[model samples]
Target: MTLPGGDGPILTCEGIGLAFGRVQALLNMSFDVRRGEILSIIGPNGAGKTSVVNTITGFYRPQQGTIRFNGQDITGLPPHRVAKAGVARTFQNTELFAGLTVLDNLLAARHIFLRSNILSCAIYLGLAEREDIRARQVVEDIIDLLEMEAIRKQEVGTLPYGQRKRVELGRALALEPDLILLDEPTVGMNLEEKEDMVRFILDVSEEKGTTIVLVEHDMDIVMDISDRIVVFDFGVKIAEGPPAEIKKDERVIRAYLGEG
Candidate 1:
């Protein structure tokens, strides 16, 4: 559905509720990821931050509420369908193909966009060659954007931890998603790596105009990169606003920083 924002949100989660047996994971979790904007979801560990991402991406179906993307109801859809709907995500852990070369991993991500028949690919037909070239061009572009051109030919497993994370980001971008969900994109990185991630995220939003939904624990990074922030605690939303407003929110302070 079109959000209150004029450009319309690329994603909207309304009254989202989920339960894992007796434990409530999320309740009435509502928010909008505005078109071409970065929306950060922040909370302490086990505050259902990742659950919100899973619910939106169809990894887990919410027992209540609706999720809409580009004005279409996407709730209950399968993960692949949600992905094909222009929503792409990266796991908190780098999920790269360990043995695959960086370029190969990126090509794998674009498999959904490939139309060549298996027989043609196996035989290396003219049509398959054309498809391969097109896919390679896309991968090359992502390499440049993510600054992985130098390592494109290297095996992903041989790359350092920070480079592997970048490869994961590249794989996600290869999906050509309109909205990208980043789950702790900078987690486990050094300060320099975190700075690079923050810069890249901002560049992606500004240059590519891709909407972003980020679940981040780094408050400084979140505050610096996000256009808006959503705070959650005990499975419920406590505050939602711009970075400045959220920083001053008492609920957010109590939930994250403890009583002060």
Candidate 2:
């Protein structure tokens, strides 16, 4: 897409290896996520795509290599700490309070800004009430931007799959993250739904200037949206380049696209 931020990478992952006992989930994986650009990681079914995201967000610890975000070494940081550092992630499967309304679900994601002590919250005093209003305002803007006004008060579980996925993206937006990791955002979506998601993702990157590291299996969409592409296979990175170069890579063809 010829987006900016070629100065340097915002997140640099080098030689990352993580395993569960004897089962290696990711091995010697490396890539760079540029600031304010979309970088998509694509591969076959058991290619350790999610493992890379989990390790970057501190859900899993890698036995080898280091991760640097915004020029700071953030390897092995806790998930909460990672969030505080402006890196957020969405799960491959939906992760939301199903019984809660969409608004409430988004409000819950605004916990970082809940600056109220027990006393102020208990009495609904100055600071607590002010924080509540501010949080609501922020979340409402996200709702509007995501075009989720109709279902703002609907219970999350009652929404259709596409809407639920949209809400999950909204929750991540509520965090006001500098970098967001999206895992399989459009897998089950129909063509129209996928188009809408692509628009939202592009809007978030261009308008808000947020960096995105996406894990998506849809080759067409990934090649269309991503500024850079990283291909993985059997717990290792196979190729890294822009979409055009990656499409013509011999190793990637043999390993991922299976055209060799």
Top candidate by lDDT: 2
Estimate, for each residue in 111-230, the C-alpha lDDT of model 2 and write its tens digit.
Answer: 997979899999996888899999999999999999999999999999999999999999999999989999999989999999999999998888788999999989999999998899
C-alpha TM-score for every candidate: 0.96, 0.96
Estimate the lDDT of model 2.
0.92
Segments of candidate 2 deviating more than 4 angstroms: 1-3
Please give, for residues 1-260, the per-residue lDDT of candidate 1 as tens digits.
Answer: 22325586778889999999999999988888888878899888899999988888899999999999999999999999999999999999888899999999999999899999989989886989999899999899999988998999999999999988888888999999999999999999999998888888877777787888899988888888888999989899999999999988888887795664
The residue pairs that clash in candidate 1, if any, are 1-71
Report lDDT per candidate.
0.89, 0.92
The window of 10 residues in a row where model 2 has the poorest summed lDDT is 1-10
